[model samples]
Target: MKALVTGATGFIGSHLVEELVGQGYYVTCLVRGDSDLKWIENYPVKKILGDCLKHEILHKLTDEFDYVFHLAGLTKAANTNDFYSTNATGTENLIKNVIKYNKNVKRFVYISSLAVGGPSMDGVPLCPCSPPNPVSEYGRSKLQGEEAVIRQSDEIPVTIIRPPAVYGPRDRDFYMLFKMVKRGYLPYWGKSFYSFIYVEDLARGIANSVKTEKTIGKTYYLTDTETYSNEFLTDTIASELKCKYIKLRIPKSAIPFIANIIQKLTKTSIINSDKMTELKHTHWTCNCEDAVNDFSFKPEVTLREGIKWTANWYRLHKWL
Candidate 1:
């Protein structure tokens, strides 16, 4: 089997690339000219240099592939237009080029976010059947990308995988928490609960979706079937760090004002008011029943085990 993976250098994408190579598949990585290729440097794969937003590049890159894993999208940006251009337009461009040129492509797996569904309306876990109520520009743009891909389901096999708070070794997003836990200070914002998936588990889920016939035209929420509170998460990290967990709970109302001041002065906003509001809203859990039933998806690593592995990686790399 031959496959093309976009965002091949990203946190989850890099892991997926490694898995694909290990499975003995001929993998082609679509990356920008300036992207760092250190992760997959040791792996044997074809590297195509081009930007996803460029039509000529997409036309050239979509030539011969059995599957396309559309994982390239902006996760965090200061400007909203950057999100729309990169996430929405980039996806449309890829789909258009694939339909026009790559007629033999059997599967197009899109790596979307759980944020696309926004917070749950009640205490119910977010499912594939819920209507999207995206709150941030990031979420909105991802939803737009999903719509674009779904429009091509008639001509191509498309599957969407929405993962929530993925973390594992070499993950920078959750590395901050590991650092805090190492320092014996674990801070949390709200009393809400959220779900997570190990990066390896998510990568395997994506690969399964590509190989499974029933996954086409379906959206799967790839997450653990466990919900954890912010306090519980902090404690787990602290336990893995072998430190006394010092919990610091700040008032939720003060996050916006502090975040705004930090944004104005340092031009670095860690957690904005809007993000805090989303955090306080809680119920960010997701149901993985569909993925499990269809693809035999099961998260191999427990939360504690994953955290220990992440903490060890951080220590070895001197990141903690």
Candidate 2:
């Protein structure tokens, strides 16, 4: 089996590449010329240099691959147009090329975000048929990307995986939580609760689902069935790091405002107003029954265990 993966250098994509390789698939990483390869440097995989939206470069991009995983997407931008340009148009371009050049590929798997489906009402896991109500431009663009892929499902086999807040070793976003815990502080914000998955668990779920018959034309939320509270998350890290922290619940609405102010002062896109749009929500859980029923997808790590492992990695790298 040959697997082609875009965004192969990213946190989740790197893990997926390793998973595919371990499963006896020859993997090819589709990465940009300037993309950093530090993450996948140890993996035995082939690399093709190109931009997804560059038609000439993406020609025959999926040739000879048994599966194609499209994980390349813009998660943050200084402006809204960049989000649509890369997430929506770039995704459309890649899928169109796949259908035209590699129609015989077994599956074109798209790794999407839970943000696309927005927050579940009253903190319940979302039903698969729940109407999409994307709260952020990032979510809206990703939904458009999902729509583009679903539109082409008739021409090529496709599976969409909407992964929740994923964290593990090599993950930067959640690393901040661990850092705060290490410093004897558990920053609390509102009643915000989330569904999360260990990155490896999500990668395994994606790798297993692609070839399965039922997942081909469907979308699945790859997440731990359990939803996590902010308190649980900070406490877990504090325990693993052998640290103590003061915990207090700040207003959830207050966090986005602070984040916006920080971004303005730093002029950094990382914590911009766009991301705050999604952060303002208190519930972001999703149902994983479709993935479970369709592909027997199971997460091997408990939150406690996953957090411990992440803690160990941070320590080893002197990041904690």
Candidate 3:
């Protein structure tokens, strides 16, 4: 089997590429020439330089691959339209080209975000059937991407995989918390129930979606069996790091100011006013009972084990 993967250099996408190669699929990765390649540089997979938003670039590819994994999308943007342009329109472009050119493609797996479905109500885990109420611009854009995939259901055998906050080796987001804890400060925002999945387990579930027949034209939420709060996660990471840290709880009202200060200092804003909407939401837990029953998806790494491995990786790489 052959597979084409976008976002191949990203934290989750790189892991997915590794899993695909290990499963004996000849893989071709679509990435921008400027993308950081350190993550998958050791892998012996074909690489194509292209941008999903540019139809001309995507149009150049031949439909020789048996599977297409669309994982590329803008997660952070300075404005709402940028997110839609990249995440939603980009997905539409890819799906359109796949349907137009790839005749033998068996599956087009879209790796979506739990943000697309928004926070669950009353601490309940969101199922796929739950009504979406995306609060952030990024979430709205991701929901657009999902709708784009669903629009092609008649022509392409697509499966959508929505994963919650995913963290593991090579992850930059969650690693920030680890760094903070190491520096003797554990920071958290508003109270919220969050869901998490280790990167490896999410990759496995994604691969299973490709091989599983029942997942066609269906959506699956892949997450660990536990639901936790921000404090719990912070505390767990501190425990895994074996560090002492002062608890810093930034109130919801102050997130916008903090976001501005960070953006100004870094000259880049991964978090902004739009992100505050999600931070203030009370729940982000999702139910994965369908993934468990249909794809036999079981998350093997608990939060403690995953955190330990991630912290160790950061230390070894001198990122701490």
* Top candidate by lDDT: 3
* TM-score of each prediction: 0.95, 0.95, 0.96
Candidate 3 weakest ten by summed lDDT: 263-272
Model 1 lDDT tens row, 134-181? 887778999999999999999989999999889997787688677767
Question: What tens-digit string does per-residue lDDT give for candidate 2 at 150-202?
Answer: 99989999998899899999987788778877877654656578899999999
**Residue 184's C-alpha lDDT in candidate 3?**
95
State the local distance difference test value for candidate 2.
0.87
Off by over 4 Å in 3: 267-269
Which pairs, if any, clash in model 1?
Answer: none
TM-score of 2: 0.95
- Compose the digit string of candidate 3's lDDT tens values, residues 1-320: 98999999999999999999999999999999799998888998999989998888987567788999999987776656889998999999999998888856899999989998898867889999898889888999999999999999899799999999999999878877788888998656666788899999999889988777889998889999899988788888888878889878788788888887776675435556776678888889999999988888889999888888988898899998
